[model samples]
Target: MHVVSARERLLTAALDLFAEHGVSGTSLQMIADRLGVTKAAVYHQFQSKDDIVLAVIDPALNRLGPIADEAEAQRGNAARREQVLAGVVDLVVGFRKVSATLSFDPVVMRLVRAHPALRNLQRIRRLLGGTAPDPGSRVRMAVIAGGLMMAGADPAVTGLDDEDFRDHLLAAGRRILKG
Candidate 1:
């Protein structure tokens, strides 16, 4: 059997708590409690809540690098846009709970906006045809991206099987991109 490290345990517990409560609402003590460890043990692994939050989110945000690269490598605008939309949909659906939690969480959003990861996120947005500087274009981008994230995270759609959920989500994303 594989052994789960203490750090992994902390991250898993943190993600769960962050999803249930906003990042600010989740404390290191809570994570330690969830893991049946002492707070000092958790601190040994991570210096602060911010560090824990960044560590929890880094893996998911790091995935955007390859997805963005693939879209950027596409030869045509339409193809690049389509590739990005598809990639974003996949990423969001794959990390459904995290995507939903991060999408609506003000604390996560603030950290994300300030963090270096925002660069890759912006690249993904631009590659997905969200590049227009106009306010309307901005709104469209938000609607499409936010909609996909929220939809995948939504409890209402959990009844659908994975394939069907992905199909509907992809179709909606395609329509939004085309507009």
Candidate 2:
């Protein structure tokens, strides 16, 4: 049985197609085919590919928000904060290639940049602190975001099982987040 929701099916199919082909290259028709639904049904759920692009953005980012927020809030000392950051990293890297592509997509990048919700992302980044006062916070946040994207795409990390990958990434995150 198709356990995935229609919205979810479309989204999963759309992301795979979007990453593989790009926004301009992909069509609702293609997405419908990927989901084994009629074009009209897909259209009913998402007005257009643009709508799909918008819908996917937050889910992708918010995947780690709970953990990120927790880490940001729970962290007290530098060492503790680093531990929370490490949890955030593990949360993001959990999505692996999907998150990697979502991060790098020029289309989504442009959309999020213009989207009103851009504030949401900006706040998250500020919390992550792309550059810290010690000149280290900036590097850690950069490393946190960039590293998650890269680690997702890396073959070495990809080949490992979820538990193994999480363990290694947590370790990596601890070191990087602390620096």
CA RMSD per model (angstroms): 2.2, 3.1
Worst 10 residues of 1 by lDDT: 95-104
Model 2 per-residue lDDT tens digits across residues 80-152: 3564556555655556756656666687778767766444444455555553577678778777767765677
Backbone clashes in model 2: 4
Error in Å for residue 36 of model 2: 3.5
**Per-model tally of clashing residue pairs:** 0, 4
TM-scores for candidates 1 onward, in order: 0.86, 0.77
With a 3 Å backbone cut-off (N, CA, C), the pairs that clash in candidate 1 are none
